[model samples]
Target: MLRRARIGLALGGGAARGWAHIGVLQTLTEAGLAPDIVAGTSIGAVAGGCYVAGKLPELEEFALSLTKRRVFGFLDFNFNGSGLITGKRLCGELDDHLRPVQIENLERKFVAVATEYGTGHEIWLSKGRLVSAMHASYALPGIFSPVNINGRWLMDGALVNPIPVSVCRALGAQVVIAVNLNRDIFGRGTIVPDHEATDEGPQGLEDLARARSSR
Candidate 1:
């Protein structure tokens, strides 16, 4: 008399619109569908990490409070011209909520994806430093600073595997459920890959979120 296993739960990134994860997770909870392997990119990484770490409630609260002002508070908004998202303020906020909960100590098995810009390799994070991995996964190239953990510069995981079904499948998760919050945000003659010249501004991102939410 043993229960079955659910393979994967994929979360998508959508900046401020990541709040939709709250709703989706709520439904999943009601349905009693707990995924064994979880994966996500960008803000989606935040959702997946917090969920696997048993801190979804706090993450939901944090996502709900992401007003324009509050979101800006977690940026590298310095007049001295600093790195993009060089601020640890965002991670600090996550720590404040998910304190006492480490990534490896979670109850569920989790996976996070990060892309190596130098080698074009996809770094799948199923183990090792949790907080650092979360920070690297969410650090949107030009929007946030790159994470140099032990000399490895890592940015957003979505740069490569936005929908990490393959990663989850690789980790032995045969059944995958992917929740994409960043559908249609880019890759259509918009938001060029070059960070500095791209046009995924706050307004544009918010608009994308709203549009997705409506649909």
Candidate 2:
């Protein structure tokens, strides 16, 4: 009898970096376990493409150089009046989750919060500030705010907290948090954490290979 099987794999950290996509493809080629279908989120799409098409020798170097140049150019602008915070929460199969509580303790300012799920629930918050106060809050860790990237508000991290509801709705995920804010790119972007899952990475590769072989 023939059986149908499936597996899930997750890769994070520097390994998920843009240039590293080529490396992942090369490794898969060497192992003879090339993926039949490749799908990814955010920058992972770039890597997934390289894996299927085979690596170009200078691709990784070029990608890295471009990223650095873009970042540096944005930094030169010296705009410091924006701030953001991101949080993620895990709501395990809950229904009608409340959206984040938005508190307005001061005029023309607000605080937003929400939950996210990957391996678990995550929460994010973003705080926006007036232009004059921007510089004083630079490099404030654990917060997501607009970073000047290539002369644009990249919306890198700080936007995460305000958009969880939209992300959940779009992705059809259960609403583990309340608040019906318009989900934007904030909580919808890439997240990189250092915890390793039990069946990810090489073990995942091996399992895929085994399943393919059995089929």
Candidate 3:
């Protein structure tokens, strides 16, 4: 009997900075690596959803063709003043891309994380409408609109756990490979040129996310 390779993929969140995921995923596939399980947060869900839907190549194309505007659309203010992001466009995109695609129908197990804003609890949904789970995963507070799932309000998973490689491990993946796209390799914060004309790097988004969770 041929032994099967148990592989798991963990994806990270990064607002509009998920283009790297497309490249990384393509590289892994080209190298003959197949994941038996997938885990993701925020933009990672978009990429993960495509993979689960068996549309990796299409996802690559989508990432390459992905514009800053389209990615930023998730952060734009909607007709509803409370949420900075309007769910219509984001949900529409999910519907258009992952049509007729079910998570349970995927070649591999899929998991996406979401956080309940009320209690700041992590809700990992392994079974449900793939796109709906993804929508909740990418719901970045103050950026993307909150998603209502089963009467629970959820925001981006990154706010709670940006990396959930352990989730895949717990699910029985023999080998785990996680991709983190939110990392600023150089640790260089954003610089602002004020009247002083000097570089002033403000806090990173992750820090802001932490602040929000505390409140």
Candidate 4:
């Protein structure tokens, strides 16, 4: 018997740009290039997690239904944590879509990356509660609140591994296809120079996205 090369997909972190991952997955499926293992960071975690849960279509519908008003309506602002939004409403909506899925039971290998708040260590979530893992991975400092698990506060994995290509390899992938939505922003001729630097960075994902769209 011959062995099939396991294909791994590394989904990058880019907040709203992560929505493009849905299209990427759809295209891959149509081209008969589906991944055997999937790894993601930040919003990539959300999309990849939902895809692994077999509820990606529902997730797409939820995304499509979002309007400015509706998106604002999801805000549950607070000052208790590192971010403005408490993440309760956001997690609630996500839980509605991925209520009972656990990482340990998934048919395909899945990984979600988060960063330890104080140490900046990369946390690879491959077990336990799936929704919580997704939230921890999606939690962005100064935007969405940090998630605590086992006495450690965790935030977006973009601080460390935005593309998580190493994670895909760690999972025993024979081949890796990484989708980096941050390409345009990080690529040459894209980012603003040091002269245009601002002390106040983007307060939220929307602000960063708007800046990207403008340029």
Reference-based TM-score of each model: 0.77, 0.29, 0.77, 0.83
71-146 per-residue lDDT for model 1 (tens digits) = 7666656444335557588777877766555555677767666665566556555545566677777777767777
Sort all candidates by lDDT, best to worst.
Answer: 4, 3, 1, 2
| Candidate 1 lDDT for residue 4 | 76
Cα lDDT of model 3 by residue, 168-191, tens digit? 787888898888876622111121
Pitting candidate 1 against candidate 4, the one with the higher lDDT is 4
- Which residue runs of candidate 4 sit more than 4 Å off their true CA positions? 184-215
Write down the worst ten-residue block by lDDT for model 1.
Answer: 189-198
Q: Which regions of candidate 3 deviate over 4 angstroms?
A: 1-5, 67-76, 79-81, 184-215
TM-score of 1: 0.77
Score candidate 3 by lDDT.
0.70
Q: Could you tally the backbone clashes for each prediction?
A: 3, 32, 0, 0
Task: Report the number of backbone clashes for model 1.
Answer: 3
lDDT of 2 by residue, 89-192 (tens): 11110001212211111221111221122222222122222111111112223333432311222222223332223322332333222222123333344332
Per-model C-alpha lDDT, please?
0.67, 0.28, 0.70, 0.78
Q: How does model 4 score by TM-score?
A: 0.83
Candidate 1 vs candidate 3: the lDDT winner is: 3
